[model samples]
Target: MATVILLRHGRTEANASGTLAGRTAGVHLDDLGRTQATRAGDRLAVVPLAELVSSPLERCKETARVVAARQARHDSVRPRVHSDKGLTECDYGEWQGRKLRELARSALWKTVQTNPSAATFPGGESLPQMQARAVDAVRRRDAAVGSAHGSDAVWLAVSHGDVIKSVIADALGMHLDLFQRIQVDPASISVIRYTDARPYVLATNSHEGDLSWLAPKHRRKRTRSRADQDAPVGGGAGPGTPA
Candidate 1:
């Protein structure tokens, strides 16, 4: 299957102020956030993205546009940014637009930190609900990209910190309750490749690296073997090398 690059949106004024900007309109990337997004775009410029998907929220859309623009400069095909509400931030409901320091004082805050599966926002959705939709959206889009562009295809999804963490947790086969343990910093990159057997987490919470290695290589046409569906034993040779 195709590899999906999960990108958390750049920082915003709300982020710096420690506020939950959940589904809030007009919340955009701050100055540092724009710089962070630009750096991320520079890193991904070498990759030939098959598709670019983003949360409908403004912050994510802004980040996605930067990435798509970078791809346009190098690749003949200009990657189109597609919006997916499923990839949006968790509905914080009454909690939206509130300061994190205050929210942390709530009794439910403990539940959200330790037992997210059972914690539901006062007027919004549960963590489990958020994970369900996010994982579903990524898996569905991954399948479509693999079918359309082949197993070597690579794509991207720009979303919120919590939402991306949920998807990463699911890909790692970890329970949603443990998702908080996964840190998804602003504009950081995480990668997952879904196979028939299981999902392979290639990288996570990465802020810098040479991702040119991920660019699709030109090779002879051949059928995929069972090895392609499974991880090599004894930590076999890495990408672009003979196994």
Candidate 2:
């Protein structure tokens, strides 16, 4: 099992303006977004991350860089950043660059809110498909990291709000339609660990908190008990000692 620290990219100009900038080009984080990213990076600086992954989108890449820099400040084993398209923002298609207020008026908006599993953006992807891809991407990455760095490894993924929310919903074992109940704000951190039994979500949408405890602790050596040391050499009653 390896832990994934899933983070949403910092707010962009479109995000502040309440627009759906889905798949839009050249949408970088705004000034406040930069500050938010820095704060998020600070929160996670103490964690010994094995990898830093991001959506290829500019906002996510920028946020990932900030987190990587903060982590590298003290940790000598700085992780290289990797990009995955499956972690990209939801394809809003015609809704791209549209205001949320206006989009909320559309009939599809109700579907998105009330029954996301049935919501499909025109000329784009369905909500279910989006969730599937995002979840798959995370699982694939987690497996790869676990194999490479061992079960205790910690990794980071910088993605979009919807993408992270969908992944969290899956981790929580919630249905696609219920995923709308999960909120993922910009620069927020969420955590999920894939175990042999099931996925465990340790945190979600955390804006501020102490994450230093997540850093790997040195394993303490086991001390031998007095009885064990005195009673036996290699078991088998130890030369007629108490059976």
Q: What is the lDDT of residue 213 in candidate 1?
A: 78
Which candidate gets the maximum lDDT versus the true structure? 1
For residue 30, what is the lDDT in candidate 1? Answer: 99
Error of model 1, residue 220, in angstroms: 8.1
lDDT (Cα, tens digit) per residue for candidate 1, span 40-136: 9989999888899999999999999999888988775678999998999999899999999999999999999999999999999999999999999
Winner by TM-score = 1
lDDT of 1 at 217: 68
Model 1's TM-score against the true structure: 0.96
Report the lDDT of model 1 for residue 143: 88
Q: Please give, for residues 94-146, the per-residue lDDT of candidate 2 as tens digits.
A: 99989999999999999999999999999899989999999999999898887
Which runs of model 1 end up more than 4 angstroms from their true locations? 219-223
Clashes of 2: 0
Candidate 1 all-Cα RMSD:
1.5
